[model samples]
Target: MDRITALRARRAGIIEQMEAIVASVGENEDLTAEQQSQFDALRAEDDRVAAQLSQAEDLERRRAAAARPAAPLPGVTAPVAGQPAVPAQPAEKGLTFARMCRTIAAAGGIPHVAAQIAEANGDGGLFANQNMGSGPAGGFLVPEDVSTEVIELLRPASVVTAMGPRMVPMPNGNLTTNRRATGANFSYTGEQTDIDATGYTYGQVKLSAKKLAGIVPISNDLLRASSTAVDRMVRDDVLADAAQIQDRFFLRGSGTDFAPKGLRWQALGTPFATTHIMTMTATPDLQKVTNDLGRMELALGNANLPYTGAHWTMSPRTAMYLTNLRDGNGNLAFPEMQDGQLRRKPVHVTTEIPDNLGGGTESEIMLVLPQHVLVGEHMGIEIAMSTEAAYKDSSGTMQAAFSRDETLLRMIMQHDIGLRHLAAVSVLTGVTWGAA
Candidate 1:
């Protein structure tokens, strides 16, 4: 069964045990110390289950709201000519993300408070299943609409994600897909000739959930604000921070027990890391620069890989350098830069690819087939707010939230990334294509 159903059953079992313990007591007889302790433990466990269930139900609500159509507003006027009708706003009184966070924080991270806020905003169904969504420092699920906003923000900010990689659902936190390992042998056979038994080889690609979490302390006043500007401001804050962090991991993460293996790590080892991976030479020669670009594509092309979904990625510095490259005749070296493309494919530039490789002056360029990048998503973003929690900063110094009147917002996402085919990536290291 799914987590929510299991939790519901577990909570029911705990409730039955608690009832039995209460029944063991005689009329007007107080429970023994052990009984009281057991009861308290069961109560706490129930609360935790209820909290998880509440969040799961919230996620279900968001999913339902996202899937179903919004009810039309009563007494609303018709749209103007030649203009698409504005769909009714989904949330009432502008139940913006900031407003939800403010409500939760104001309630001191109480989940029932979220239920109250949802009800007040005409969304009684948000927590109708179980209302204790916040269990201590645990967080609430981001609303579906807001979660969508996060995705919109994620694009253009996260280079890999912006390219629209293949999304695979990991509902059970694990997935395995069969990948073709070899082409089937084929040969012409006459009508009476014995047919040769040949079959395509296959391999398995596995994905498991990995947790990515981030914590930030926001000004209490920020969450407490009533203006819609606060909503946009806080959303932007999350967008900028989340984009950078996600891109960094997606680009250079060491595939360990912690973070999912990124493209850089995927490029390592095998023939790709050596021969398939190209090395760059610094020069202002227009032909030479274009030659280097050709070699990168040839690495995959020689392997019979398709070029349908190919794209280029480099640092901003590399992109600007290539954009302005000029030969002695003053003609642009790569004219496709005007169309936001390179080598006739789209380009994504991010600073996550460092320039410190090879004596600290070199950077790298990546040409990728976006379709080969697989993202296994377990769930959308989850957020928890706390007013009394203490957090450690980058310096490992503890910062007290209550002391500073700050709200600690912790966000967690569970997902993993993999390459459907490692050969789909080509990298050029020690790149000085844009260097003077």
Candidate 2:
């Protein structure tokens, strides 16, 4: 029926043959070297086939057990807040990548010790290439642990702010003086009479005016630096989260191990890192995922940290993956569309992987109760900022007045979307810069 079944059948035949060989060896005292070699080869083949069959059978059993319907524990109601609920379907095999590098000039070395007993060894454990994860002294590989690290927030860097414009009074208006050549060499009769020193005073007093200038608001470099730093710090925190998750899998373990890739260190210390760029194709509803992320984003906005700017538009595909979610009705609820579309309700959510590098890292954090799963639980999530906008209030109009014409102009300050590990920590990147 299967390779395993076939192998078992072949092994049974081999055993019979091996028995005959044993009988012959006893009766004849000695057999030809060629026959003895053949017997030994056959015995070895039989053992190999038997092992394969046993392994196949074990796999089948585990699969069957996993397929069995899960029964809820007696009296276990709602899952505690902040924890992802266990998936009713076998935990979807998932992978996360993490990368950790030193932002400082030097990083300490990671300590080594005997590998953990649970670590994958020379033979492939839960994943392939177990050797790749091994470190010197058979210890697990990990980011160099450091006692002191920089917290970009505390640094002088911050968002730029305009305390309106400073006023330098200018001479109100332009002045022009006309000095008529009253007494020219060829003047009119009356003028000629005035030409004589006794007739009119030849000397003239001329008046000219010089105007004082105005002072304009200067660009705040320090504020820009601070905003940049805030963005970098948030992103670094996210990267750190991914790094922590990766560290947990330093030793051999199931699922894919994520490593940071395409890390771009831009000016102002902004670090753009993405999870291992692997794509998974599934029926994961994108719309539901979008709504969930939007709610969180709105919460961040309401909390006052809207750093990301217009550049933070999320992809429609990513939105579809995020917005449609299970609702209070315990039914698939699309944020935009209240009613369920397809018969398949949103059972679980795989947060949209954030794109467009920003200050914060996407996390598998957040607990959401799904309608389909018997145990309402939180699921790991990916997040990205869709868009960020900002406004300042100077002239009650939320606009700044420039000195150029002493006119009030509305200025929309742009910022980048920033993700925070928690709502309390989200400081919208670059939204409000220079201190007023």
Candidate 3:
């Protein structure tokens, strides 16, 4: 075996042996001297193996990096005599606010330039006065690199983005795409027979942009702290909240008011209809789950939907219960559950799927082909700051005027979600774990 594989195998063996040694000693009993010595020796060996594995992995990574060709620098030319040589691009590094600003500026966007101008002018733009660093008001814009780092730190882990849906950049107010329900057919003819008209149905799905915004209040003191520190804190908080709201609406939104129509709601409409909804038997157990999954597969097969890249989505509680279930032979009912999958399909666990539905305690489990899900997002986020503002109180029942010492930051993002094909999603409703 290769060095890395051999090291990993050795580590696994050591871990197994350690587990055996621990099990040999009764729960309430102490290990004998010999046993203790053996344990210590095994631990030391394990540590050595782990260190070697880490080194091997690092070496492999370096080798891979060295093997790849360097990317050509754009807009960079050979240096002339008397002029300093243009520096080669540096290695990939973590995100920073300064870098973010430069990138934004490079894109010819207004936000990055505005931030820089605000910082330089000391006009109290996007950042607080103190965070602007030792600078006259006229040169206050945070460094592009610093802004890049801050933006990187604020990025939120996105489930919708992870699913790899078809992303359409909606620059206009609305986007419309024609979807074909059927295709034209051709057949071989012996003679010059009259051609028959092929029947095909087409429909359009219109996705209109919906706005999601969050307002954050920060004390002047906190805002005046290190711009990096304050930017990190505020950006993370706002983006995280926005990501959660987006994910929730993308999965279960009813498309009311400002919310986008999500997968669950779209599956209930025409083209998909209720045929994709599968109801479990009286007792919802592991066997029933497996059976329902089989039924779903069959339904999709009959509908001629490809099963590749399909995934299962359910609540964490349901997943935990299913993973812990044992068969009649005391073997794991679903051995692959440890990998967060079912029947070789990836499983996504999210609380967005409500547990209280049909029976007030029923949860939904769905099989979805992410490629059929269409998601649209506006490219950039807009951020504005206000020192004098009226904000909603904690209860949201009353408006409170901001104190002179406080500042309010408002962030706005726009996006929408829709399905290209309803049959590509099938849901199992009224599912419950354990005994009926």
Candidate 4:
């Protein structure tokens, strides 16, 4: 039999023996000393065989994918004489951020474990220059493919990205661009007569990296049972927490010293609030709600902004309200709502839009020109781990990782959001359509 088959067979036998040992004990009766030792040895053997089987399966998948011929390049009428065309690099199936985190934790948070893991997975040349030095703040730089996957996965998880804004790379951790402040005056003038001069002014739109960090405490059991499933669980949990926090700052940040100025703050800056802020004076009906959204569009349209890339942002509660609202003919007022569009523009529903603005019974709706919204990110996600550090739990109680036998995986991302034009954002406030 092949090595893989033999390992699986061995693991099955170990499981059967372990089960028999457990069955030997009566209900509510403990195992004898001899039986306990035998079970422990068999359990260890099972874990070893499982690891071997997992590695073999991963290698088989890689081999199969590699064996497939590369698809022919489109629009290639002739071949180049110098050399063969380079194939597109794929995200490696071997090294992942979660797998890297597992290595670091298993090695007691040593950063160089990343390099060791990479070398063992036939990627020695790829990570040959990884930093091997150790320091407190020093952490493993995640593989490029893994970091790219994390960014792509963040799109569906983050409303800011799901809305399809302009993504800007901030390698230097900061960016600045011109924002038009006023337009030049134009009027009829007499031929050869002295003409009044008018100059269009400009302001600055700046984006600076802000540190966002989250700690995910993983069960120690995963360390012994590492696999692709463990990787997915770690990646998903981190994505959910990271996106939720990012949406909060991207939508409602008060432009404080600690947080980036969000869409609402940008609208409340001045001219937008005066012209674009639509207030709900009464409980919304089909007509009132439709009119409110219409006025919001007009607010931007009147400013000469096109609805080509305009998008809608509201809370889940508000979306359902519109979905349930019916017209005079007893048909859906917004029939296309189920397809995630309002007025034919894409709609992004997120709980980040507060429903308790005034008197704990209000919400806000934002119509934005996505192209005018910029999300600048520095280097992607970086990971660090700690086995001896103490951190506060979700309930505000302090817990030690070493004592709990859990690993604290700390993920840090640096990114910031800004608007090239503040007028590109319009908000409707004090909405109580679906208030409880």
lDDT of each residue in 61-152, candidate 1, tens digit only: 88888896455589865566799876876743223555566667766876655555555555556545433464566367776666656765
Regions more than 4 Å wrong, model 1: 1-95, 114-134, 143-149, 152-156, 188-196, 282-284, 391-399
Off-target runs (Cα >4 Å) in candidate 3 are 1-156, 186-195, 216-224, 227-231, 386-408, 434-436
Tell me how candidate 1 scores on lDDT: 0.77
Q: What C-alpha RMSD separates each model from the true structure?
A: 9.5, 32.3, 26.2, 14.5
Q: Report lDDT (Cα) of residue 156, candidate 2.
A: 14
- Candidates in order, TM-scores: namely 0.74, 0.16, 0.61, 0.74
In lDDT terms, how accurate is model 2? Answer: 0.29
Candidate 4 lowest-lDDT run of ten: 126-135
Q: State which candidate, 2 or 3, has the greater TM-score.
A: 3
| Residue 81 miss distance in model 3 (angstroms) | 17
Per-candidate Cα lDDT values, in order, are 0.77, 0.29, 0.66, 0.80
Q: Indicate whether candidate 3 or candidate 4 has the larger lDDT.
A: 4
> lDDT per residue, candidate 3, 1-436, as tens digits?
1666567667767888998999998889999999899999999999999999899989988998889655558986645669977699873333233323322222223333444444443432334322322222112344445433433433324555556778787888578997767767877766788887787678777888888666666566655454555555655655566666667888788898688987777767475565788787766666776788887776666667786678787887788878888888899988798997788888887777777777677888778887888877653455445555678755885444345565555555677887777777787777776423
Candidate 2 lDDT over residue span 171-259, tens digit each: 33222222221233444467436553322223221212221111112122221232334334433444343332322221111222221
- The number of the candidate with the highest lDDT is 4
Candidate 4 regions with alpha-carbon error over 4 angstroms: 1-95, 112-129, 132-138, 143-145
- Say which prediction, candidate 2 or candidate 4, comes out ahead on lDDT: 4
Backbone clash count for every predicted candidate, in the order shown: 0, 54, 30, 0
